[model samples]
Target: MDVDLVVPGLYCLRPEFGQAYLWLDGRSATLVDTGIVGSGPAITALLTELDADLDRIVITHGHQDHAGSAAELRAATGAPVLAHAGDAAAIRGERPMPPPVLLDWERPLFDSIASNVPPNPPCPVDQEIAEGDVLDFGGGARVLSIPGHTDGSVAIHLPRSEVLFAGDTIANVDELMLGVFNVDRAKAIESFRRLAELGTEIACFGHGDPLIGDAGAKLRAAAAKITG
Candidate 1:
């Protein structure tokens, strides 16, 4: 994994498959996601290189790839961990991986990814957020409760910057598309539509390169395709 500055304060920690982001703010920063197990050391190293102390570790959902290192990082930094209430138990490792309804072609890929994530012990969630909740980070980021990838999946929007931290709700891996292998595809599509309506100039995804310009339009196109 390597770290690259995507924007002035947004740094993308690009991992092989999954990704994590650091929102830099002087000496303190907020981590959007934690990559799979054994990713903690690298993440901390990057944080040190940036001279940023971890202020909070915010999880976008319960998926192992997205939250695997949350406990380790939280303990390492003494930072509170936050996630949506619906997936808090799963993020804490109290619940099994949500069974996904997937296409035949996606089954093998999904299984391979699932097999690689080591089981993590329970991690306490310091706070549970929901839609309309505004976190005191990056000036302020509004939480959009977008369920589909996982029941508590969310997108964090920085209106002041027109940036959307779009977890797995929407992906730009090969193209702008809705999250694949969802537990609830319909709900995921609905969430995609909601996210499309947001005016975003930059979009950060959990599994792909970020879209840096006119992201809202791309999201709208993806939503329309999904809906149609």
Candidate 2:
């Protein structure tokens, strides 16, 4: 419920199917991921509350829930969208990969639905991130290419706050195991293992709640489960 004031400089914009995070670094702001299609209104409401102008939308991946509303956000704010090149197709709904979950019979049925889900027009990205590359979003916030969840999945790291916006490239992907959705099982696990080494104090996961207090310890435990 009101994650806006609680999160302070950044707030959560929970749209249908997915959630978007907003951070204000002064007059300009940065949004991490755009929710699924029809999320334009949620974003607008969040921005209005923050009273900030969005300068950029940083996509963590290309999945529909993450990029489906990218074009809309760009149109509304004229902000530049930046994503990884490997996931360009997914963002465009070109080589869209269906979630490898759902009941056995639901796969094919969902495939057809996948073809019909409205693809948000398209927006040319202003930048393509590569592994190890860091994007200084002014102030001390930066973006890191964490990959794994998708070939191009990225995470936003705020060293000043010791908070990392880890986008599904995590160890215990509880959602995937519960048959929510997943793309590459192996890659996702590997990405989680890598983060275990980050020793971040607080982790802002894309889903669920933030990992606070002993995140490094909890993440290590999750990493162990992945290895097993």
Candidate 3:
């Protein structure tokens, strides 16, 4: 329910398992992740608080919790959906993702929820992105590909502000759920090391509260455990 963590223009809506972010650049806002199916009202409330029209909705990955409301939100906002090509199939609900590597206990729970995510009605992708690609919002906000959480995972890195919207490639230290359920444990760790190199000051993850203060130290610590 902690919807607004305003930092100049970034606001966060706490969604279950994963969270969504609203980047207000001007009269329009760039929404990253639409949250789970039961998140429509909370998302709507975020828009109300921002007072900015959702210009475009960006899906960081294809998981249900990250993209559940995409089609519905698009209808309401008339905003285009942008995602990487790799996991587009999963997003469109054509094929469910492979189970997380090394985690057997959580498969049933994930499969159950993923089945209900509802295929996002195959919308033509307005833009297909790859790593290091820059997506502009008139001012300065770029969507950088970090991958690994899924083949198509991405992070919205506002270089000008040194803020990164780390989709699920990496979450906060407290995210026990993902600790037990990552599709590729090694790659996810690699992705985290990659983000660590970016020198991002504030990293807002999809599944937990944003990482604040000396993020480099925290990231390196996480990377060490993985490397070890």
Q: 1 or 3, which is superior by TM-score? A: 1
Off by over 4 Å in 3: 104-124, 173-180
Q: Local distance difference test, per candidate? A: 0.87, 0.68, 0.72
Give the CA lDDT, 0 to 100, for residue 24 in model 1: 75
TM values, all candidates = 0.96, 0.81, 0.85
Which candidate comes out best when scored by lDDT?
A: 1
Clashing residue pairs in candidate 1, if any?
Answer: none
lDDT of 2 by residue, 1-228 (tens): 235432557666666555567777766688888877878767866777767888888888877767888988888889888888877766665675444544466577668757765665566677786666666663566656665567778877776666677775652235322112345656666667766667577776656656666576777776776541
Clash counts per candidate, in order, are 0, 0, 0
Number of the top candidate by TM-score? 1
Give candidate 3's TM-score: 0.85
Candidate 3, residues 33-98: lDDT per residue as tens digits?
Answer: 888766766676668766778888888887777887887787777888899887777766667766
Clashes of 3: 0
Question: Any residue pairs clashing in model 2, and if so which?
Answer: none
Model 1 RMSD vs true structure: 1.3
